[model samples]
Target chain A: MHLLPKKKKKPSREPYREISPGSKPVKWIYLSIMLWFMGRAIQAAARVDKTVKAEFDALPEGFAFSLGVFPDGPYMVLGKNIHGQVKSLGRRGQEQALDVRITIKNIEAAILLFTFQESTAISTSRDRLIVDGDLSQACAVIRILDIVEVYLLPKIIARLAVKRYPTWPMTQKMIGRIRIYFRAVLGY
Target chain B: MDTKEINIIQHRQPGIVESLPYNYEFYNPVKICSGKKAMAHIPFELAAINAVRPLVLASDSPIGRRAIKLLTNAFKESEMSFYVCDDVPDNADAETVRRLTTLYLEKNHDAIIVAGDGAAVDIAKVIRLMVAEKTDDLEQFEGEIKLSHAPAPLITLQTFDGSGLEASGWATVCNQTFFSAQLAPQICIIDPRMIIPMDIKTTWARAMVSLTQAVEVYMAADRNPVAINYASTAIQSIRKNLAPVFSNWVSNKKRLALINAYTAAACAFSNNQPGPGFLLGKAMAQMGNLNLGTAMGIILPYVMTQYMRKTNCDLADLLRPLSSDDDYAGTTSSLRGKKAIRCLYDLQWTWHQAGRRKIPLTLKDAAVGRYLFPDIIETALKNGLPVFDETDCETVLEHAWEAKPLNVTS
Candidate 1:
C-alpha cells in the first residue's frame, strides 16, 4: 500500500482570509460565508473534544454561529451584539439583532453535503462540501482560527460569485480534492 | 536464434477449498506430502519448465512462510525469477482467483512452487483448469477423465493428507458447495518435514481415508494386482506406522510410519477408480461432518470384514506386510481379518485414553438416534457402490448400529 508524507506545521499567523462587511444587504452575504466555512470546519473536526463556550466567545462580534453535535454534547452559545450597524443601499439602516443557539453532540463520522442556489443577483450557486478525518484536530484548529477558509469555498462561492464562471465541474473537482484530503488526514 | 514463446499467469493458492474448470489439463507428479508444511518433489515437467522459465514460491502458513523465504533465497542464489501469491485469504473466492490470474498474465510468471496442504495445491490446480477450460465450475467436470493436454507446469508441495488428488487427475473441495476434480497438478513435491506438524486426530483421519481407499480397491470387482499392492502397502502402513505415531508424536519411527501410510494411500488412488472404503469415507465425511480419515479408519475394518465373510480366507494375503510382526505373525487368515476389527476398537480406545473425545462407534451414535441407514444407502446406490445391495446394506447397517465386532466364520 502507498502512503503520503505528512505536512510540516507553519508558524502561527492571523486569519488568512475574511469576508468584509458592506451594506445591509451585503451583511447577509458575509454572514453566510462565515456560517458555511465554520460549518464545514466543525463537521470536519467532528471528533475533536473542545469547550463549546470558548468556541462561541472566540467568534467575531456582530456574527453569531451555533455548533451542533448530533446526539448529546455541550454547545457554545453566542449572543447577538446590538452595537454593529448595516447600511442599506447607500444609507445606514436600523441594526437587526440576531440570536444564535447551537446544540453539539459527539457524532464523529464523515458527512458529505452538496447544495446549489440560484438568485437573480448571482449567476450560479452550486456548492459541495466534504468533512472527514480526525474530528479532534479540526476542532482545535477551529478554536484557534475563529474562521476556516473552507477550501471548498471556491465551488460554493463560484456559483454565487462571478456570473460567467463555471461551477458544475469545479464543484466536482473540489469534492474530489476534499475526498483526497480526508483520505490523507484519516490515513485511509 | 529461435527463442521459445512464453506465457505467464498468476494463480491463487487458497488455504481453505476450491474447485477447478472442466476443459483444463492437469498433471500430478505422483509424490505429495501431507501435514502442516508439506513439500512435493518437483516434477520432471516443472524441471523442464525451470530450465527455460522462472518458478515462484507461494504459501501463507507459518511453515509455508519459512519455506517461501528459504525457497526465495535458494532461487535468488540459483538466479531464478519468482513471485509469491500470499496476499489472498486462505479460502479464496472466484473473484480472488481471477485477480491472481490477471497478475500472472501481467508478470508472465512461467509456473509456481505450491506449498501448503490440499487447499493450496487444489487452488493452484483450479487456476490451471480455469485458464484451460475458460470456466470455473468444477462440478461440471467431476468424475474420471483423461487430461492429455498439459497445463502450465505447477509443482505442488503437500503438507496435509489425501491420496485421491495425488493419484488421479482430480481435486475435490467444499466452497459452501461440493466440487470435484477435473484436472490434476502438473508436478508434486513430497517431503516428510511438512507432515510432522499434523495433529494426531487429523493424521489418523487422513490415514483412514487413504487406508480405506486402498482396501476398497483391493475388494473392488475390478481389483487388479497393481491396486492390491498399493492397498496392501497402505493398510500395513496404517497398522504399523499410524498406530505407533498415534501413540507417540515425538518418535521419528512413528513419523516415518505415518508418511509411509500417506504415500501408500496416494499411490492407491493415483488411478481414477475408488473402492468401498473410499466411497464410505467420502460419504461419512460429507454427510456426518466426520473427518475423512477417522471415518475411513472407523469403517475400513468393517468393510473389509464384510468382504472377507463372503469371500475366501486366502484373501488375507493382502495384509502380509502387517502380518509379519511377531504380535501377528502366526495369526490365521480368518483371525487376521478379526484383527482388523480389533484394531479399529483399539483406535477408539486410544482416542479416549489420549483425552480426545471418542467418536460415536456406529451410525446410531454418529446421528444421535437419527436413522441414517436409509439415507446413506440411498446415496450409495446412486453413486454406484456395488458392495451391498438393499438387503445386504440393511444387514450391514443393523450390524453397524449395534457396533458388533466381526470375527472369523467356519
Candidate 2:
C-alpha cells in the first residue's frame, strides 16, 4: 500500500519572459559627465590652443555637429557661432539644428572609445561609429575629436587614442593640457 | 589524369567561381572556418574583403543573445566595433527589414554579419540582396531566383537549429523563395559556442533535412564525383554524431560534427537541382505548416524507396555511410538497398519513440490529410524539380502518409 503511486503534483507554470534591451546605466552616467567636461574643454581649447584655433578658422562659419550615442544621448554639440568662437552646447535639444552628426552605435562601443580602450581611428575603421552629414565637415569634426582626446588623456593613453601622435614640445604639451583643464573646470 | 583531359578553371578575381560541363565541374567558393576559436577569425575575413563596417543582425531569443555575447567576446582583444541589432523579429516583418535598411545605409555598413538562424539569416541575405542589387521591391523577384553580381560579404553564425540552408544560395524571406549561388555566404563560421542544445523534435527536423540534401547529391541523376565526395563525408559524419546527440549523451564536439555536416551538405546540394525528397519536403512543410526538417524526415524513407524504384541505380552505396563496418559487410549486396531503407525506418522509429510520439512518422501522424496533398504537388511543380512530376509527388506523399515503404521492385 505504501509503494503505491502518490498524488501527482501540479507543475508550476513560468510567466512570460522577454528580452530587455541591455543598457549600462553607470556607463551612461559616466559618458554624460565626460561629454560635459569635454564640451567645455573643447570650447576652452579652441580659444587657447593655436592648432585648434587654426582648424576652426578653416571651418565654414556656423558649422555645428553633435557626437553621442543613438536613441538616447548625452552629447556635446560644438559649433562655430557668428561671434567667431567655438561654444560647447551641452546636449543639443531636437529643436537645435545640426550640420553634422557623429554617432557611436551603442554604450559598449562608446565606453571603449571614452575609456581609451580603442582609438577613434580604430573605432571608425572598425565601424563602431557612424557619421551622418557632409563628408568633409565630418572629417573636420573627427580631427577635432582627435585633438581633444590628446589633451584629455595622458601621453601613453593619448598616443593609443590618436592615429598619429603630434610631436609637440614638452612645455607646449604640458602648458596646453594645464590650460585646457583649467578652463574646462573654471566654466570658461 | 592527363593535363589536357582536365582543364581546371580558377576564378581570376575573388567572389566568382565558374562551373564548366566538361570533366568534374566541382565548385564551392565558401571559405569555411570551423573548430575552436573559429569566431575569432571573422575579423581577418572582414579584413580580406576590405570591409571595416559590418552590421550584425541577430534573433532576440536567449540563445541568440548568448551567441552575440560569444561573438562580442571574440572581438574583445581586437579594435573592431561592429554594430549589432539583436532585436530582429522571428517572422521577419517588412518594417524591421526596412528600418534595418535605413540604419545600414545611414551608417554606411560595408558588410553583413548574421548571427542566429532562420529569420535572422533570411533577413540578412535579403538585406544584402536589396542593398547590393538596389532592388527596392523584393516582391517583383518572387518565385524566381535572380542575381547579376555577388552580394556584399556575408558571414553567418548559426546554432544547430536551422533549415540547414542558411549558408546556401537559398533564402525564404517573407514566404518568398530566392536562390542564386552568389547569395551564399562568403565566410561560414562554425563555432561550437554557437551550438544550442535542443529537444529531439528540433534535432530530428534539422538532421532529416541534412540527410535529404546529402542523399540527393549522392544519388543524383547526373553524378559528379567531387560533389559525391562532399555528400558522402556529411552522411558518415551524421551517422557517427546523430545517435550520441539524440540519446541525451550530447557534447560540444558532436554538435560541431552535425553543423559541419550541414555545411558540407549545403556545398554539395547548392550546385545540383533539389531531389524529389528535398523538393517534397519543402512542399510538405508549406502545405502542413510543419517544420521543414520534420516534414523531410517523415518523407525520407518512403521517398528513398520510391527514388530507388525510379532511379534503379545501385542504392547499396547509401548503406556504407549509414551503417557501421561489420553490419554493412554482413548485409549481402542484393539486400543492401533494402537494408538501407530498413535502417532509415529504424531511425525514424527511434525518433518517434524518443519524442514520446510527439515526432510524427507519417503525414497523417502530422495531422496533414490527403485534401492538402494537391498543394504539395503544385509547390513541387513551382520549384520545377527536373526528375519529378505531379504524379510522382502524389505517389511519394501517399506512401509517406501511410508510414509504408513503396513495394514496387525495379
Candidate 3:
C-alpha cells in the first residue's frame, strides 16, 4: 500500500487584530469624570475641613501642583487661589509652571489612592508617587490631601488612609461629614 | 521596633520642616582625576598638591603588580621620582601601618600614592596619619580623633572601585576603624585600565560594597539632602552601569561610570554615620571569613525590609533613580519599597548568573550556617545603629540567614 503520503497542509494565517484607535475618546471621557470627582472632593474638603483649608492657605499665591498618571493619564492641578482656597484648575499640561507636582506612577496607583484602597504614606512608601520641586511644599500638599480624605471618607477608611487621624470632636466630625457629602454631591 | 513605633518615629517629618532642628556638618575635599587614562594625570595632580617625591603603596597581588608597571611606565619619561612598596598586606594591621610610616619617613617621600584595593588604601591612610601626627601609637588616633594638621599629600589610585576608601575620611586598621577628615585622599585617580584586568567577581564584589555603603547612607538617621542626592545618583549609576561592565569589561565608559558611582557613594558615606546594615555586615564578614561586600550583599535587602517593617518612612523614593519611568509608573506606591528590595535581589541573581563565580544570594548559599546566628546577632547588637536594639538585630540576622526570596505576605 504505497500510497502517496498526504501533503502537509500549510497553516492558515490569522488576520492581525488591530486595536481600535477609538480608545482615545473613551480615555478622555474617563479622565473628565476623574477630574470632576477630584474637583468636587477638593471643594467639599475646603468647605468642611478647617485643616485642609489651613494647609491651602499656608501655600504661596499662584502655587500650583498637578496630580496624575504619566504620559496619557488624566491630570488635575490644584492651585492656591488669591482668596486662599484650593481650586482644581481642570485638566491642564505643564503650562501652569506648578510649584510642586505630584505624579502617581501609574493609573493603577491612582485608582488605589482615589478609591482609598491605599493611604498616601503607603503609596509613598511603595514608590508610587513622584514629587517634583520643593519637597516641603509637597509635604504640605500631602497634609492637605490627608485632611481631605478624613472629611470625604468614613472614619474607618480615613483612619487607614492617613498616617495619623486627628481626634476631632463628635459634633465637628458629624458636621464636617454632612457638609462634605452635601457639597460633594452638589459639586460645590 | 514594631511597625507602630516605626510609624510614629517617621511621623516626625524632618523633610517638611523649613529647617530641621537637627544639625549636621559635611566636608569632602578630594580632587578627582577620572575618565580615559586618568592615571596619566597623576604626576600633574602630584605637582598640583605640591609634592615632588611620592611613595606608591600596593599589595603583592596582580593588581599591585600592574599598578606598579603602569605608574613606572607613566613616569618613565618624566623626571618625577616615585618609590614602590608592594608589600602591604591584605589585613592592614597596626604593624603594617607603622612599617609603612617608617618607610615613608626613611625614604623622605613627600607624598603617597595608595594604588590597590581597600586594604592597601587603608594602610596608606594610616601611614599618612602616622607620618603627619608623628606617632606610631594607633591608640591616639582611635575612634573619631581630629587631626590638627593635614597629612602629607595623598593621591589614591584605586585599582578596584568599591571601598570608597579613595575618598573616604575613615580607614580600617586591624579590628578598629578610625575616622578623620585628614584621612581623605588629596587626589583620587580612577583609570579604567587598572579595573579591566581584575577578575569579574572581585570587580562585582567591590561595586556591591560601594552600593551597600550608598544604600546605608540613604537609610541612615543622619541623612541630609546633599547626602541623599549623592547616594541616589551613585545608586542610579551603579544600576545603569553594573551589568554592562560585567558583560563587557573592555568598555572604558562603563568602568568610568562605576568609578564615578564609587566616588559619589564614598563622598556621601563620608558625610554620614554608618547605618546598621554596614555595622552588621562588617561584623558578619569578620565572623564568617567572608568578604565584607559578600556579607553586605546578602544582608542589605533584609535590613531594608526590616527598616520598612518598623518605620512608616517611604523607602520607595529610592526606586525613582534605580527604575525606569515606565516601571516606576506601573508600580503602585504601597508596593514600591518592596519592589526596590526585590529589584536588588533580582540584580544579585543576574550578577550570579552572569559571573563565573556566582555571588551568593543567601547566607546558606555562601555556606554561612544558621548556627552562627547567636554570634552574628551579638556582634550586630554591639555594632549596629542605636536605633536598632538587640531584638531588631536578631530579626534581621535571622531573615538574612534564611536568604529566601522575599514575599509580600511576610
Candidate 4:
C-alpha cells in the first residue's frame, strides 16, 4: 500500500538532427560548437593583462577608457596632436586640444595601450603575436602596449618597436589613449 | 502573412533564455565592412611593426591559402612575420580547436582572422569562443549571447556568400543545433572577388536564401521599422542585381551588389528576429533533409503573395518603396501591395528570361511528392514554431505547389 504507483513514462527527447546508425551530424555539430568556444577563449586570454585591469579599476569617476592590447611588447594606443596639445577625448567627447604638448601626447598614447588589453584584436602566432589592422587600429593597439610598459611594469628589457612617442602629458591623457585603443580592438 | 506586431524577444525566448530578453541596443558602425586588397596586406605589417603577433586562421583550401600568401607577400617586403593556421580541419573537432588555441598562445599570436565560407569561418569563431569563455563543449553556451572574456581582433572574410553567418551571431553547424553570439565574428570583410569564383548553382541557392532572409526580416512580427527599411533596400538591391546574373555570371560589380544585398538581408533578418518565412524554411530543411536555401527559394514567392493577401495595408507600405517605376507617392494599400507583387512577378520573369533559373515549381522537382506534405506539416508543428495551424500551413504549401505569381490588381 505504501509503494507508490509507477511514475508516468517520460517522452523521449527527439534528437535535433536525425541520427542514423552511422550518422555523425551530432558529433560534427558538437565539434563545431566546441571549436567556436575555443577560438573565443584564446582571443580573451591573449588580451588580458595585469596592468590593463588595474588601470581600468583605478579610473576616476566620470573617467572612462578604450584600449586594444597585443599579446606581447609595449602596449600602445592612438592620440592626435590638435593645434599644439594632444587631446584625450575620443569620438564621443569634444574637449579638443587647442595647444600641443609632448607630455599630453604621450599620456594620450599610454591610454591607448591600456584600452587595447580589452580589445578583440589580439591574436597569437607560432613564434610571434600579431595584432592585425589599419594605421588607426594599430595605433590604438600600440597605445595599450605602452601603458603596460611604462605604468604597470617598472623596467622592461624587451619592447615591441612601435612608433617612438614622447611621454610627458598627464596620466589621464595616457589612460584616454588606451581606452580608445581598447574600443578599436573590441570593435565597439 | 496576417501580421500582428510581434515581439521578437518573445519568439525565440523559451528555447534560448530565461530573462525574456535583455535590452539589445544594436548599431552597425559601418553598414558594410569593405576590405580592399590593401587592407588585407596592411594589418600584418602594422601588427608586426608593433610586435603584435595575431593568429591567422584560414580555410584549408587553395583559395584560402592564396589569400594568406597574398598577405605574407605584401608584408614580406615590409619585414612582417606571420604564422598561418591553414591546417585547421574542415570539420575541426573540439580537441583540435583547443590544441590550436594552445598553440596560438604558446606561439604568442595576438588575434585571429578567419577566411573562407561558413564552415571555415565558423570554425575560427568557435576557436575564439573556446579561448575567451574557457569551454570545450560548445553546447553549454547554446541559445545565449553568453560571453565572459573579450575575444581577440577577429575578422571573418567570406570566400563564398549566402550562409548568413557573417552578420548573424547564430551559426548552424548542422540542422537543429546552433552556436550563439559568443561565436559572433567581431568584424566581417566582404570582397566581391571571393564570391565570383563560386559555381552558379551555389550562387543561385545563396541568392534565393538572401531573398527569403530579407522578406522574413521585413515581415517579422517583431519587425523593427529600422530593420524593415534596411530589408526593403536590401531586397530591391538583390532583385535588381540577381536578375542579370543568370545570363552573365561574370559581372564583378553586379556580383558585389548581390553579395552586399545578402549581407544586408542577413544583418536585418537576424537583428530584427526571423519571421514566418525563415521558420518555415528551417522546419522544412531540417525535416526533409533538403537544402535550406533551395527550400526558401521554392516557398518565398508564394509566401510573399499570401502575406500581401493577409496584411494588405502593411504590405502596401512595403511595396510603395519598390515601385520606382510607378507613381507611389500616395498610393492606396491595395494598389501598393499589387504593385509590390507585380514587381516580384517581374523578378521571376527576369529570372526566366535570363535562363529559367528558379526554384522548382513543384515538390516533384524537389524529389518529394504530395505524400510528403503531412510530414512537412508534422515537422513544422513539432518544432514549436508559431504558425496559425495546419490549415495555414496547407494554404502556404498549396501556393508553393502551384508556383504561380499572384494577380496583382493594379
Worst 10 residues of 3 chain B by lDDT: B12-21
Q: Which stretches of candidate 4 lie over 4 Å from their true place?
A: A1-188, B1-24, B29-31, B35-38, B41-51, B74-80, B89-108, B174-176, B179-182, B308-313, B325-327, B356-359, B404-410
In TM-score terms, candidate 1 sits at 0.54
Ranking by lDDT: 2, 3, 4, 1
Which residues of candidate 3, in runs, are more than 4 Å off? A1-188, B1-23, B161-164, B248-250, B329-335, B405-410
What TM-score does candidate 4 get on C-alpha atoms? 0.59
Q: What are the per-model DockQ values?
A: 0.00, 0.02, 0.01, 0.02
Q: Which wins on TM-score, candidate 2 or candidate 3?
A: 2
Give per-residue CA lDDT, model 3, range B178-271, as digits (tens). 8887688888877777774345666676777788888877677767777777888889888887776666435677777888888888888888
Please state what fraction of the native interface contacts candidate 4 reproduces. Answer: 0.00
Residue lDDT tens for model 4, B1-410: 22332335323221123222344444443224443342333443335334456566766455565566554533332334556666666676666666777776677666666656666666666666667776666666554456778655566665544366566566644232444544565556566545534444455667778788877765665556566666777788876776566544357777777767777776666565555566677677766777777677777766666665555434554464455535454555346656666666666556645645444544456765666667888777766545336766677776676664444321
Docking class of 3: incorrect
iRMS values in order, in angstroms? 29.8, 13.9, 31.9, 24.6
The stretch of ten residues in a row with the least summed lDDT in candidate 2 chain B is B11-20
Least lDDT summed over 10 consecutive residues: which range in candidate 1 chain A? A104-113
The residue-by-residue lDDT of candidate 2 on B1-410, one tens digit each, is: 65543434221211012222255566677877776556766765686688977877877566566676777765543446678777788887667777777778888889988887767888888888888777667777765466766688899886788778876787887778787777788988888878767777788788889899998885676657677767878888887777667655657899899999999889888877788888888888888788888888888887778777776765676776777656677877778888888877887776577667768888888888899998888987887765667777788898888775676484
- Best lDDT goes to which candidate? 2
TM-score against truth, every candidate: 0.54, 0.63, 0.62, 0.59
